[model samples]
Target: MDQTQSSSKALTLARHVLRVEADAVAALADRLDGAFDEAVALILARRGRVIVSGIGKSGHIGRKIASTLASTGTPAYFVHPAEAIHGDLGMIQRDDALIALSNSGESAELLTIVPIIKRQGAKLIAMTGNAASSLAREADVHLDAGVTQEACPLNLAPTASTTAALALGDALAVALLDARGFSANDFARSHPGGTLGRRLLTHVRDVMRSGDDVPSVTPEASVAEAILEISRGGIGMTVVVSAERRVVGVFTDGDLRRAFAQDIDLRRARLADVMTPRPRTLAPDRLAVEAVEMMEHFKINQLPVVDDAGTLVGALNMHDLFQAKVI
Candidate 1:
């Protein structure tokens, strides 16, 4: 009961728990076999969603697994086991697949519904620590999620078992993702409001300011006239175009400052003399994220957008992309 003795005991318990959980997850690699494939096959073949359910800690893990499957191009959702028996069994359909979690495989609430799910012609996939237990034996496919020992010293808590189940769930998700050739674009579509979705789906045309919003000047345009266009457009830069309206170069505020440093007469100088030649431009078809990358890499804030023939079509600044969430 002394302070030092209490602290020492707690530290020892913590170390033992960490070691046990780590071993639980590490053992999962060797446990991978055809059952994982059978589970994926059941899910990939389903016309309806994957219905995940469990109780307590297993329920928490089931919800996360359902979300991962849903966001990764597999349609899935979670249903509470107790709720399923109370008219929630209607949630199960002939085309859907069910994934149930139970470390003991004998949770009365879960066992109560396995027959009902099978009766409805829905396939049940069980993730359990005991293969011979009721839920596992009844499942169309049973995944072994056994742990060598619980992290609890008395060996009766769900700690290591839950870790094993979560890892196995992730393995199933990733395997299906690869098998289906689910790409980043597919993930982004399911997550359109998320940052990754914005980065992947935004095209230059979606964010680039067009028509009267663009700053443009003729190659014959005077430096003073180009400055007026840039100032009017408020992009801190102007696209210098030829008589045919094709972009030949770009002039910015820095170009004007350099002109001032050299004592060049703004009224007399032409834009070509002060413009940066071979200025970078993006096609409207390019991803807006690429535009952000170009701006960051070249250290420029404003860029001209051009057509396949290199004619000036539009202009954009960093602010435009930021507002569109492409940055």
Candidate 2:
């Protein structure tokens, strides 16, 4: 074929493959039945961890499922079937539950250790295309992961079948996660380096400037005094306060520019006259991400942190959220 024709054919084939794989994954939802429920129940009842095993492409999918299960409060690990035959079968315990994946339900490597797992009193859940296959028949629960066709043009590579298996694995993990009442905080604990961790685990108090670090000026002070405080605090804003240290208003660099443009004398202007009254604020215990959202919404760079009675306790700026990775 010519170069243009070859590229065109390849593009068409790629689209066709994606369509076939997508259909395979979609069909899994309709195939759900009593077996899926049984599998979930068995796993939930187990006091020990889940042992996932498979061979070849199924092994790759099994590893992902095990990882997902571990992260979502299910405590699972993948064991290569080939390795299990060599010596890794020692990892399986009597109280553990086993999930074995094989499209044909007849992989020799998996069969080698299945009997030992059963002999040890571990429950076996089989994910396979053939319900009548030996592994499915022997399993305590059989989850149907069948697909009608492969995405490969030759219909020989494991494409649609693997996709269906992977989707079913995700469904199982999510079902278990819901059953266990796993919260966002629990999920964040498993992914402390991720953005969700920063959002859920970081509070405003952890990042906000406290004590004398917060810029402040009395309402009776001059606008020039507030400007000096804002500069000294380096957060581009200063809180105007009452005698009892309750926040009355806030004066930012932006407010200074506007005041100057209006021809107001900074030296003579009182902070009360130049500051924004009752500016947007947040509680110290609130999430840093909430501060980010409020700042973005109100177009403010800094916010005074307050107590339940609206007493000024701290101060935070956009840089604080960014430094905490909440941005």
Candidates in order, TM-scores: namely: 0.91, 0.94
* Candidate 1 lDDT over residue span 256-295, tens digit each: 8998999988788877788888899999999999999999
lDDT per residue for candidate 2 within 171-271, as digits (tens), equals 99999999999999999999989999988999999999999999999989987788789889999999988988899999998998999899988778888
Candidate 2 weakest lDDT stretch, 10 residues: 265-274
The candidate maximizing lDDT is: 2
- Model 2 misses residue 283 by how many Å? 1.8
lDDT, model 1: 0.91
What RMSD does each model have against the real structure? 2.3, 1.7
Candidate 2, residue 259: lDDT: 95
Q: Which candidate achieves the best TM-score against the true structure?
A: 2
